[model samples]
Every structure is written in C-alpha cells, then in structure tokens.
Target: MLLFSRFAPNVLLSAAVALSVILAAVMLGLAMDQRWLGLKLEAQPRLAIPASFEGLWIDAIEHDSPAAEQPGAGIPASVASLVSIGGPDQRSIQLTPQDLMEEPDALETYAGMRAFFARQDEIAGILRSIGGVELGVAFLGETQTYSVSPKHQRPVTSLPPSFWMQIGVGLAGFWLGAWIWSLRRGEWATRFLLLAGAGLMISAFPAAVYSTRELALPGRLFSVLSTFNHIGALTFGVGMIGLFLVYPRRLVSPNWLAFPAVILGAWQVVDILQLADGPGLGFHLAVVLAMLAIVVLVAIQFKVTRGHPRDRAALAWLGLAVVVGAGAFVATVIAPNVLGIGAFVSQGEAFLFFLLVYVGVALGVARYRLFQLDEWAFRILFYVVGVLLLLVLDAILIVTIVDERAPAFALSLLIVALAWLPLRDMLARLVLRRAELSRGNLFRQVMDVALTPPGRDQQARWRALLENAFRPLSVTAAADVQDPALIDDGLALAVPGAGGLPGYRLDYADGGRKLFSLRDAELAVELTTMLANALESREAYEKGVAEERERIARDIHDNIGVQLMGALHSRGLARKDMMIRETLTDLRDIINNASNPDLSFDEMLADLRSQISEHLFAAGVKMKWEVESAGPAILPLAAAHTVRSVVREAVQNALKHGQPKSIRVTVRLDEDAIALTVADDGSGFDPSSVQTGNGLANMQARVTSLGGRFNVASGVEGTRIEARFPVDIVRITQ
Candidate 1:
C-alpha cells in the first residue's frame, strides 16, 4: 500500500476536477440560457388589414332613385343597406359589408354581426346594374387576426442552426477541456487551457440567445448578457495569454497575468458606468489588446527559442492557433461591429476557428512527439489551402452556373480532384524538399539495436539512431527519463529510462524556419522507447551475471556448506559418502530449478518426499509422507525451493539430532494459503534451551520473507516444526 501510494495521483482526477469547475461556470451562466437578454422576443396574436382583398369587391349597385324608391326596399332596412345612393341618381354605388358593418353599434347582437356580411355578395350583385352607370363593387369584411403581430417583429422560437452551433461549440469546449486535462497528466499549463474552455462554454449561453440580430431583447437582460460575454472574453483572453507566457517557455513572470486582469476590469468599469460612446467597446478593445499581447509574447518566445526547435515549434503552433482562432473571430464578429458593416458569416461559424486554436495547441503539446514538423506543417497547409480554394470555387459556382447544392458539390469535388490534388502536391514538394523516413523503416532501425553484439557501444549507437531519425541538434542524457515529457512544447522530448537504464534528452535546433511538431515528437518517442529497450537489455545482461554469481554463492553457503560441515563432524565414511552424494544431488536440483522456476506445490512436495524418504529409510527410520493440496497452487521459484529445503532440513534434524524412530511429513492447502508440518516420535528438546544457529535462523528467515509463519512446537512425546505461506489465487492465475 505504501509503495503504491508513492506514485502520482490517478490521471482521471484531472477530468473530475475540470468537470467540477466547468459545471460551476455553467450554473453561474445559467440565466443567459433563460433569455434574460432582449435577444429573445415572443410574438403575440393581433388583428391586421388584408391588403390582398383591399380594393376588389364582389359587385356594384346602381340605384339612381331616392331612398323611398331604392331597389330592394321590399327587404329589411338592414339588408337593403347593401345598396346606397352615391354622387347622384345617375351614379352607381358599391355598397358592401364594409358599409353595413361600419355601423355595428346599430345591430345589437353577434347574430346581427354575422348576418350583415352573409348576403353581401348576392345583395351587391343585385344592386350593381340598378344605376345606368356601372361601378366596381367590393365587400370589406372585418379585420383578420394573424399569428404574428405586424406591429412587432419577433424572433423565431424554434432552435436555429446558429443557436445549435453556439451550443455545440460551448459544450465542446468544456468536454474538450476535460479530455485534455485528463490526458495532460495534470500539467499546470493545461489547467489554464481547461479554464479557457470553461469560460468559452459559459459565454456560449449569451451567444446562443443573441444569434438572431432581429430579436428585441430586454434592456436589463441585454446588459447582463453583455456583462457575461465580456467576462467570457476576458477569461478566454487571460487563458490564451497565460498559455503563451508559460508554455514552451516561461518568458514573463506570472505577475504579468495581473496586467490583463486589471486592464479588463477597468474596461468593464467604464462599460458599467456608461462612460464610453459604445458601452462594450472598451472591454472589447481591452480583450483585443490582450490578444495582441499574446501574439507578441508568442513571437518573443519564438525569438528566444530560436535555436531550440521544439520550443520554437510550440510557439509557432501557438501563433497559428491565435491567428486562426482570433483572426476568424475578428473578421466575423469584432470587425463588423467596429466598422458598422454587415458580418459575412454568423458568429457561430467562429466556433470552428476556436476549435482550430485548441487543436493546434493540443498538437503543439501532445502531438509534437508524433510527427515531423516540416512534413506535418506542409501537409496541414496544403490541405487547408486546398479546402479553402475548393470553397471559393464552389461559392463561385453557386453564384454562377450552379444555383443548387447537389450539382455544386459534385463540381467542387471534381475540381478538387483535378486541381486541388495537383496543386497541393506541388506545394508540398516545394515546401518539404526532404523525404521523411517511413514508420516501418524507423521501427526496423530501432529493432536492430537489440541484435547488436554485447561488446559494441549500444548506448552511443542508439543515440546516433535517434539523432538520425529525429534530426535533433543535440542529444544528451537527462536524469534517466521515466516517462515522455514535453520540453519547451515540442522542441524537445524527454524520454525516461527503460529497465533501469539511463534516459536521454533530445534537442532540436532547426533555425526559425522549422520547429519540432507533434508528429516529430511522436517519432522521437518511438526512438526513445527503442533506446530504452536497448538500455534495459544491456542492464539485464549485466544484472543476470551478478544474480547468477550471488545464487551460486548462497547455494553453496546454505546447502553444501552445512552438509560439508556436518560430514566433517560425522563418525563414519558411510555417512560422509551419503552426505556427499546428497550434496551432488542438491547441486543438480539447483541447476535444474534455475532454468524452470514455476514449480507447483504438489510436484515440489512429491520430490521432497521421495528424496527425504530414501534418506530416512537409509537411516533405519520409518517415513510417513502425507501431502494434499486443495487446488493447483503455484508458488514462486524461491518460495517453492524454501519450502522443500525447510521440510528436508526438519526430517534430517529428527533423524540426525533427535534420533527419531519414525517421521511424518504433511503438506496441505487452505483457501489462499499453504501449510507444511514435519512430526517425529523422538525425544524433544526445549527450543529455549537451544541457542539460535545459522541453520535455524536461515529457515525462520526464509518463511518470514515469504510473509508466512515458522515455528517449532516440541514436547517429550513428539517434535513438530511447521511453516505456513499465503497465496494469491488471482495473481497466480494471471
């Protein structure tokens, strides 16, 4: 337990910690999701005039006579109202529901309202030809109710793609942060990155609610969203700046971080006090200045780490991240707002740009080990440029020949195959003139080190191999690397030692044009791993010689030494010859066991019984051997050897020291443990009376070393020595 505790905490804890912080940020920004801003306006039902039916009428009536002689005077006055006198008796009038319903107060009930317009079409047609002159007729019904009020425009309630994009980007930032944190093994720089991601996600709430510009958001809510957005912007800027300052190189003191905080806070103060012509513009300017500072910091890092390819590469990657992420946001969001120009793309599209920054940063730190900077950078440039070209071409086609999507997509793909591929390849060749080593070839080179002769300078050879594969400016041994480390971003990869071998530091100085990227770092790691294996092999070879010598010395001292000592003090040649033969047999057993260590309990006990029973029989002592194991218990080579030796020594003691007439050896398994006992019908001596000797101490040490108990319980009736050892069933099986 103590040994396990010595290692660093689990990597999963990074994700757990990051998730807690992000979720807290989410809850803090929850009101934004509830549409506290004026960005969300709801539509209410209202009456509207129907312009389509405005001037058109069913029929016109010409009634030149006075009201007493008007046409259809036979009908009720309310129905007759559909005909009316106009201009003079010679003129035609278009009297419809509009005229009748105009005097709604004249009718008392809902039925009268319905009846007024019911026969307007027929009444108007009947009255149309009454006058000599014909007039156009029309019926204007009551105003119609529409779902939306024409007086107020409302944002669509259904989720828009832009809103979803904001949501996805926000959530993606948080999840990506957690994932990066988990993978980073708790690097402090990654922690800042995680914070940046959380802030981005929190700010997404406001972005989502305000995606549609036409929405009429509430004033107070808008102010709150604006504040939240500024906070998010500040957080992201701080994170990015901190990452630049500390990562790849810690050029500035941590105290420099306070500058952005104070600046942003002051800007926020101005915004809150409404001191600026544009309320949020000051905060945005502060954020922009902070971002510009980050760029300068990265450039400074690049300059400082000029000769260090890995660090330079990391700074270079950060530069790209900033340009792609911040540039996209500026072009899409900030510039339009500042210039009062329409945005070409929605702010949601900026999420992709943000993702690019994260991906670039991740590559700079984690991926640098995997790829060669030159080749990887060339490929990325080619692919991105080609894709952009294709998009431009497709867009051209959209505005020209192809107005629909399907045909445009097909044509774009066709153009990509014919033009993009050729262009990308040409660009790649122009940029990356040198050919890279294939993965398989590199692996083979690493493998060849193992086959090198022992006398050769394997360490130097491995170093040379890495130098060639990675093209590092310098390679030196670092305090035996135990794991892969990113030194100055991807400028150097510190590979830990393998199998107790010394580790090496890889340094790359490729000038300013090229820096070690993720792909390069990955290949370096492979080479380092290969080097580690070679070192371990050399270490194992040297250690094996020492271990073998120790084993021989211990074996001689324990078994042969004691047997020879006993023979020297014995009385007869027969006993001496017997001891010598036993010694020879023990020597053979040691050699055999050395080659095959996994000796099971049942097999070792059977051999122990065989060897001891013969010795007891020769000594004119009856031998009763009883061995039982509940399951196939496999003991380690050393443990099995100790068990056999302890049992053998006990039987010998009973016959040689106690002069026992009969001996009984018993072995049994109990649950996850095993027990061994030797009993004899001999006169027993008090253990306290006998002084502790090398043989007795050795036996006790062996049992105790295996985490087992060893004891001798003796009485006059019989003497018994017992040893018990624990076994892990699952561990043995595995």
Candidate 2:
C-alpha cells in the first residue's frame, strides 16, 4: 500500500527513504540467505520425513559422494523401511511412521505444536555433533544397519522458497514502518510501528538464512542466530503492545513505555540465557503476554476515541488489523508452543504469516489516514460511506417491503444512488470546504485577467485569480517551482509563473479545513495552462494594437501634419479652407474596427447634427434638422462614423458645388438600422451631363459596404441624398 500510494505524486508523502531501506533490507537478506545455499536441496530427496514418519524415506542417489556410497543411500523409499539410528559413536535416535508433526498448520491447536520444534532442535543438535551429515540407520524387522553421510555441499543454483518468502515479508514490514515514519517523524504510534517492523526484520532476516540451510550449520553460530531471532520476535511483540497503548488515545504516559520495554527485554534475556526452566515456554509466554496486552490496549483505544468519528474509524481499522494479525500469530504459533501442544504450522512458515500484521497496518493507515497518512484517503472514505448506506437501505427496504426482493432492492439502490451520489459530494465539500472548479467560471475569470493591462497589473490579476480559485489560507511567492506541485504532503500547492506573475505556493486550503488533494493539484495545472493561453492571447492582441497605433502615427504625420504645414505656409483663407477640406477627406481613410461595436445612437446622431449645423450655418446656408426614433437607441460605431462622413461630405457638396440656399438633414433611428437624408435647395445637375466628385462616391461606397443602400436623386428643383445602414454589425446593442 505504501509503495503504490507513493507512486501518486499528488496523493501523499514521498517515501524514497523508506523504499531505499526496503531495497537495502532485501539485498541484505539475499546476501545472507545466499551464504548457506551450498547444496541443491529442494529438488533432491530433501529428507522428506512425512508427518507419519513412515520409516525414513530416501531417493536413488545419482552421484558417488561420501553419503551416496553408503549401503542404504541408493535404496528407494520402499526399500529403506528405516526405523532407528543407533550407530557406534553416532546419533542414537528412534524413528517410526506415525510421526509428530513439525509443520505449521492453520487448524492445529496451540498446545499440540509446542514440543515439536524442540524435538527438531534436539535432532538438529545431534546432527551438528555428527562431524558430518553421517547418520546410522537400522532397518525395522531386518537387524541390518547402514550409515550414510548426506551433507555433500555443492554449487547451489537457487535459494529456497522459504528463504525468499521470509525476505519478502521482512522487506514489506520494514517498508511499511519506514513509510509511516516518513509521514510524521515524531508521532508515538509511528515510532511504535517502526519499532515493530524493526523487530520483525531482525528476526525474519536471520530466520530466512538459517531456516533454509540445506543441512546443519555450526552449533555456536546456529545458537547465536536463534537467540537473536528470539530477541527480534519479543521486541516485535513489545512494539505492537506499545503502539496500541499510545495510538487513537494514550493509555499511559509515553515515558512509562520504558517499563514494558524493560520487562519484555529482561524476559527475552532470560529466555536466551536459559535462566528459566523451559526457554521455549518463557519465550512463548512473553509473546502471549504482549499479544494479550495489545488486545487490552486496543479495547481501551476503541473506548477512548469514541467521541471522534475520524479517530474511531482509524482506530477501528488499525485495531482490527492488529488484533486479527497478532491474534492469528499467537493462536497458531506462540500459543501452541506455550501450551506444549502440536503446532500445525511450522515455526519458519508461521514467521511469514506474522507479516500480515504489518500488511494490515499499512492498509489501515493508507485507507483511513491513520498515523498522519493525510487527506486523500477521505475520498475513499466517502465512497465507503456510500456503499454502507446502500447496504443498510437495501436491508431496510427488503424487510419493510416483505417478499419483494427484486423491486425492493431496485428501489433501494435507486434511492441510494440519488441520495448518496449528491450527498457524498456535499458531505465531502462540507467537511473539506473544497471549491467547485467550473471550467466556464474559470474561462471568464481568465479572460478578465487577460483583459488586465500587461506587466504588473496583469500579473496582479493573475495572482488574484489563483487566490480566488483556491481560497487558500495563505499564498506566498515560490520562485523555484517550475510546474504545479502539491508539496509538504499536500499542506501546500505550488503553481508555476504565468502571465508575468511569479510562481506561488498556497498553504492550508480552505483556511486549513483540509489538505490539498490530487484533484486540487490537477486543478492547479489546468489553471496554469489556461492562464498561459490567456496570456498568449493578450500578448497577440497587444502586438496588433501596437502596430495599429504606429500606423496611425504615420498616417497623422504623412497626411494631417503635412497638410497643416502647408496651411501654415499658405497666405489665403480660401486656400486654407481647401486644405482643411482635403485633410478631412484624407482622414476618412483611417481604419475603424466595425465588429461588434455599440454606442448611444441618439447621442451620436445629436453630436453629428450639431457639427453639421454649425458647418452649414457658417457656410451661410439656412439649416433645418429633424430626427425620428423607433427606440432601442444604439448603433455600431462604424454605422455612426459612416453617418457622420455622409453628413459632412453632403454639406460640403451642397455648399461648394450646388451653391445651396438652405439644407435639411434628417435622421431616422430604428431598432436594427438608421436612415439619413440630406436635401438642399440649389441648382440640381442633369443626370447624364454632370459628373459627381469623390465625395458622393466615397459616401456611396461606405454605406453599401456595410450592407446598406445609397441613392442620389437630383433634379432642377433640388438634390437629395439618402442612405440606410445596419446599426448592429455583430448583434450587440445597449
């Protein structure tokens, strides 16, 4: 669980250290286990002394080693009928078919398995004293005897399964302990878990090496390893008891933990030194007491953590894991030895089974955030509640609806789906105070940030946008982050710089109500990406704006500036008037962005009319203006500018060409468009004879280009120019 959990970058702690330790432990075990692999053991006859012991069986020897040359060494199982070993200056032991079990079993009572290993020990001692793997055997009912030396060390190509199994358990146990320790360096429970794992490793690694020995090892070396194994096992038991005493609630002061340690340490010492009458029983009894102590302490924790649901939940799972794993080990392995009974499970194999405790602890911490495992576990927790709620509802409906399992269950399922699907999120949000990350909302906010003026203002908006999105308790500049990061086990979330804003780390999401989850880290990435896109767009827009401004500057200098210089040099008023008119005409070429423009139609019209009236009056023409409205008084800027150009050009035409006496300009505003008419009482030109100037053509082109119509009616009585233009270019209005 720790291994997989750490793989998720956003989930929780980084356990490189733990994983390193596990690897180191595995390598160490492999090296130590490889030390004793001097024979091809498992594939050979392997001393297959069946529990029924049916006279010692042997396989046909293939090589002429010392043991292979013995008389009975080549005999098959059927030919052996081996009964006893009473050779001169060698082992004197009796063997029969109905044998005592030397294996660990799932069903064996504790008392049935105690003497089994001690007897094996006695046999092992005799073999160690035999100088070599030479055993004398006397066949039953035959009075013939033979001796074979079996210990021929060879090039072993493989290590046994039990060796690897023990190594695997050791690695996992140490990894779990280290993983928890990394989550919080100083928690008491975490320390206990590590202690437990250390003990298991100490015992398991040695056992992996010694238990898989092909034959007997040096008696002294064997004794030392055995003593160390006991020390590790007892230490493990004591560690578990200490863990329960402190976790979920403290049963005793942490300082007082030394007392149990000292007591168990002394018991272990006594067992090793053989000060007690039965060393095996003393060791077993110490383990049993520790297991019992764990049970009692777990009960106390369950009771003490009652008011806190989270604590209770954590304790409940951890408690169950501890109880089941430790209880199984005690009942199957230690209890039987203590009771002097036959153990169904072999001691070495039972050591492997004991590893389940660490596995369970890892799972408990991973699933429920026990021992500071962090908040990602809560997502799973909510789903767990949903499952439990569904079961409960199903049961209630089944009982109440009576004999209608199908429909009742279906209804229950539907109800739970509806209720919990939303309620689970609601509860999580309530508990965690998480924000909903809406893409639409995010888009708008990013656009607003993009609209901010680039540089410091835009950068500020970028920062504000992140703050608004996450609502963290605090935000600080984090320059080192080059990408999004959920760091300090999700205590802070960091996002890289975007849109001229510096990178930042946000701490304690939702005012410390919750840790940032993997989902939050993902959101940070998305937000950063969006901000980057927006910033690119803004940069593009600003570039276009800069080019447009430069072009305008050139236009002013080349057109208006040159004309003004000429006007300054000119001495005549008529020449200056003509120059001003030429300047206004040149101004028409200035670009106007017409897409999606909006303004008050009435205001634009009134301002244009005022300018036209003043110009016409100054030109000595009587001016009468009228405007009609159809409401929804807004129009595009392009339309307004077009109207202004037409009005100005028409007045110049009537005054300069036709020599009008009076001019009438009328504008009509409608919901979708505006219409303009300019009439002058003057000498109208003949249609076929008189040629119009650039003024009328420009007006006609401008009006028609915007999907509008233009017409000129000229007669001897007067001339009238009329044009209609769409007010909205892209459906925007006030």
Prediction 1 TM-score vs. true? 0.44
- lDDT agreement with native, every candidate: 0.59, 0.66
lDDT of 1 by residue, 1-734 (tens): 24323443333433344454455445334423321111111122122542333322222121321222324422122111122323224443344333422112123332442344343333333333332222232224442211111112222333446666666667656655544554453464666677788778766656665443322234344446556766776777777777676777776676775666676667767755646655225555666677678778777888888776555566667678777787687667665545644445656676667777766654554334312223444344344446555766787799789999889978998999998898777655554434567878776766666545544355565666766766667778988566777676455667665443457777763433344555556666676677567657766987887986776677778898888887888799988888888888788778877887677666677777778977987899998878775566677676677777788778877876788889888887776777889999999878887777745677888788778999998899879999998764412442
> Mind giving the per-residue lDDT tens digits that candidate 2 earns over 356-398?
7876675555444467665554554454446556766777787
Q: What is the TM-score of each candidate against the true structure?
A: 0.44, 0.49
What's the lDDT for candidate 1? 0.59
After the best TM-score superposition of candidate 1, give how far the Cα of residue 250 lies from its true spot, in angstroms.
23
Which runs in model 1 stand beyond 4 Å of their true positions?
Answer: 1-384, 388-405, 414-430, 438-459, 472-522, 529-549, 564-573, 631-635, 728-734
Number of backbone clashes in candidate 2: 18
Clash number for model 1? 33
lDDT: worst 10-residue window of model 2: 35-44
